[model samples]
Target: MRFSRILELGCILAGLFSGAAARPQDELVTENSSACKNPPKRVEWRQLSTTQRKQYLDAVLCLTKKNATSGITGAVNRFDDHQAVHSSQTPSIHWVGHFILWHRYFVATYEKALRTECGYTGGQPYWDWSLDAQPANLSSTKAYSTAIFDPTTGFGGNGDYMQPSVEQNPLNITGNTGGGCVKTGPFIPSAFTVNYPTPDCLRRDFIPWIINSFADPKLVANVLAQKDYTSFARAIENVPSFDQPNIHGSGHFGIGGVLGTIGSAAESPGDPLFYLHHANLDRILWTWQQKDLQTRLNQVGGPITPFDYSGKNVTLDFQINMGRLAGNATLKNLLNTTGGTLCYTY
Candidate 1:
């Protein structure tokens, strides 16, 4: 599993160097008297009250029944558009300088879809993996608690041991821990279905060792301390050697099985947790930006093309398409949460 996963990551990284590559308030409510008015709050998953969690979950489930316009042949609901968007543009967006900006727009668009299509009122929430990455209490973090895994309020726990195994990649990391469908949680096949029309359940196989080892406080501190975008992006997306420690990939690797799809170059959005993971990622970047907001806001680098041998800066006008999920948006417009259509903070 180690070698295969590492090799898979190497390909992603090679495509990246390649490209390149935060937390804030519980409720990020910012009102600018000079420019814009009130901005909504994007809270933490743990911070959400039971009621808020239910509301959010209900709306998320509701998206499954809503139709999609992304043009992916088998798409079933609005949620499918998101998955389709991620799948279609995965190559250009991932491991590129546009990874952050493109995903920022993608996440924000999903939030907008929730509100517009499902009548959801609250802003999107993020998961803070660092809180659970502590050494002493790593085994019992809230990330694996009933609060997060309960069938009623949580997304559900790992897949049942009897479920079919995930197809092994070429390197043969031998799929994740659990292979069967998710038997517990609101996402059980009997209770809910994914918009992308998968026959399997929402499986998860939490790899405690990954989080305990790679996602430690020290690693988080190292990533946070990076001075420039290049080193910072490379550190987080650490390719070349998948064995190298990286805080960004920790969450994805920590939750293996179907949930591990986040590690897939594409098709990651199929997992509902993708947004939360990316939201937290955005928060980290936002925190880094806060250290030098004036300069960081305008800072951009990395390769224009995934396979570029020569390092080149990503342009502001880089185009990203989302089909009917949302209109095409440029990397520049997606850069600032405060400027352009984006108004909320982490």
Candidate 2:
């Protein structure tokens, strides 16, 4: 197992994550932020120094070297713990009322793990796709040329040509350029391992067209112009079949590949880029919420079920959890980034 290769780090993860006694459900997690007095500010990926970028990658590597608390077979390391939980919760979290709330909490939990477990001191960085998806840049190569895909400082570039073993949903979506294993970057098959849903290389078929189509500045502005949370969520997440793809799908399909674990929606976190991608999404959500915090912060209304717009609306008190990673939290606490268990700003 990956964790066994790093004994000392394994001890750190075990003592910190597994060896602790169970606490009451009401206990605060990560840090009980007394205030956002000096909350760490998140920056765009380019804003970070090359050294800072390397440090962030190192923390992610450390996660892979640590033992997973979840004994599930596919969860070979601590990193896979997230993959397992996300895959399990996909149906409940996405397309629902708490989609934004639950993901906000999930990303915060990951930031905490990076800091407390892996000794990464920097705040999380986001990948702003808008800059790359501009109309002039939409000529196909602009988004693909981003440094975020750099083999050295970034996650890596496109995978080679190969066929997908299993066909997932959203059949209408087109443009999958590469399907083979990633040949370069920090997470090439030789340097990194992804064991969920059977071991495989981190693959990415970069369909820059998808990014250009959905994440253009005009579309993003449209999403932000939404009058309420429900409209905003639908604008970003779009419908179940992804017929009307949104920014969220832009990032996912733009990267364009089954992950190292090799699954689309559910198995996305298997790739390290998932966090950076989602961090940017969360930043957009936060940006929209700040327009009128009094109303937007409290405003949330969508179906309780995935793709079921006519179903019951999930309330603020709806519960979300990350198994042992973050026990449980409510949509209420997750609404305000700085006020709840979260204490970060973008």
Candidate 3:
């Protein structure tokens, strides 16, 4: 089937769950009482037992698969069915809205799965980044009631760059800074050289607060259940990005990029932080939705066109469904943010 036709069917499914009939794709969505809330109690990562961590990972993987499949299918179905009559003039207000809705559902679904499937009792936690700016000794990972990092036992080591400066000597001969160059001296290093290259080249010499700190685990559940846009926006704005780039060409490398990368190490995704980082990004987008209801309805600031890795442009009409890339999902089913039979609370 054509992409557009598939998306049309998906949209129909999404709308059916959302309690809305086929209508303009750009319509403003009415806030559902169950979709937003306050932050929840935080939980520390170190506090979690191995079993708990494994269960959380399992739940996250399942939820991601489910949403990705549904989202892609819906997108493809919508595109295939609406190709002929759809026009460029049609407003694209639903981009962010759809993004937000699906993401919230994504997080909530995982939280639910964790609770129901694996007997998870703790809530989702938030990592705070601002705390990393403090002085070394004074910086306590335990400052937040829900701190995820324990400074005393954290992995990055004690020193600022995790240890003494490698650039202390140029010609020490024991180490090289870069480009296969070695120097020997008790020399005051030039602008580019380092005596201890290993420490110098290390990323996360001092771990950031977000990775180390934790927020109330209930935050995800609360946000999903209430409509407090103020806190929601704050949380969204605070998500941190690492140094490495991903297939998407955005985000940080080691810390933030870790989860998103896929494939082997020689040419691997280049980071383990990718998935977790995107999950946080998705959370922020969801927060933006409740904060900016008007703009979402108007299709303001949506992507002009979807692009592939080679920079080729792809049309995003109602007919462009998700099934092509993500199996049986379609676009039509994703139009409405609420009204699905399986509703989730943060």
Candidate 4:
């Protein structure tokens, strides 16, 4: 067999037998040793030139017009698949070790859908909240007030709060300050409607307090600095030591209004911000993976399953389900975005 083929086989075997017994650390393949591979340049949202950003948005808009692949009856358009997939798998993927890998897969495939289906030429852009998490400028961060939120040039600011309180579980959380349809953005109902017909807007209640307190740059750095995967994942998701919400959750709250759909966790994908937020998360993971390439790439942490939902114990070999949007996927295949079926970098 070719060396690349051999390495691929090794990854599969390692994932399969990982839980049964310990394997030599040096035995696992690090990355594909392909001689010629094109690296994908995934830039930050802010770094994108006006044309690039518009192209990216145009592609996203294009996707909203495509038919859904999730097979859910009544579901329409590719964008709907995002909400459908996330809703069905919410129980198994969130609040677990698989959080990172599962989301990585979700965002990657979504990006792929954009390129293949909608002819998006650029890689997905990420929202690095840390840059905007500065104490002195929390209230004025460009993340919410700048071009990214421009009604014509950006996704638009908060929702218009046209409807009553939306009921999000765990807490009957009210929609953000606006709580209505997005009155100022490109995704307004007249221009583009959601999969399901709803009177509510794409709401967002920008909570500077949450961004300052939970999504702090220092806190995010500390979360990334953890030497082990479990600690890292927990800090981003649970942050047991602090009374504040998890860093990941903080981003949702920060952009939430009618965008509160993002706060829903399961329905967050309903909002376009979900991909940008997750791309940022994926960038963090990619950055961490680059530190000690071999070990970090193969390192799988936390339970294979969600702690609150299914009781199944996760093994390193666990296969992540992507619903009808993707074929069989595994952590091994997802570990290195530049390897295997993945070939992009941030």
Candidate rank order under lDDT: 2, 4, 1, 3
Per-residue lDDT of candidate 2, residues 205-278 (tens digit): 77666678777888889989999988898888775344465787777777863322233654578788888888
Give stretches of model 4 more than 4 Å off.
Answer: 1-36, 134-143, 161-176, 196-200, 239-242, 257-259, 308-313
Q: Tens digit of lDDT per residue, candidate 3, span 1-346?
A: 1112224433444432332233333233233424433323324345456565555544433332232222322222211111111111112212222333333333334344445545556655323322232324323433322222222222111122222233422212111112211121111122111111011211221223323322223334444443443233333322322221111112222122121111111111111122233345454444445566554323312232321113321122332222112211122322223423123212
Q: Residue 89 in model 2: shift from native, Å?
A: 0.9
- By lDDT, the best candidate is 2
- Tell me the lDDT of model 2 at 133: 86
For model 2, the superposed segments whose C-alpha errors exceed 4 Å read 1-37, 136-139, 163-173, 241-243, 257-263
Better of 2 and 4 by TM-score: 2
For lDDT, candidate 2 versus 3, the one ahead is 2
Candidate lDDT (C-alpha), each: 0.64, 0.73, 0.28, 0.66
Query: For candidate 4, lDDT tens digit of each residue in 318-342?
Result: 6776656765455776787876446
Q: What's the count of clashing pairs in each model shown?
A: 5, 0, 86, 18
Q: Which ten residues in a row have the lowest lDDT in candidate 3?
A: 260-269
Q: Which candidate's TM-score is highest?
A: 2
Off by more than 4 A, model 1:
1-36, 134-143, 162-169, 172-175, 195-198, 257-263, 307-309
Per-candidate TM-scores read 0.82, 0.87, 0.34, 0.82
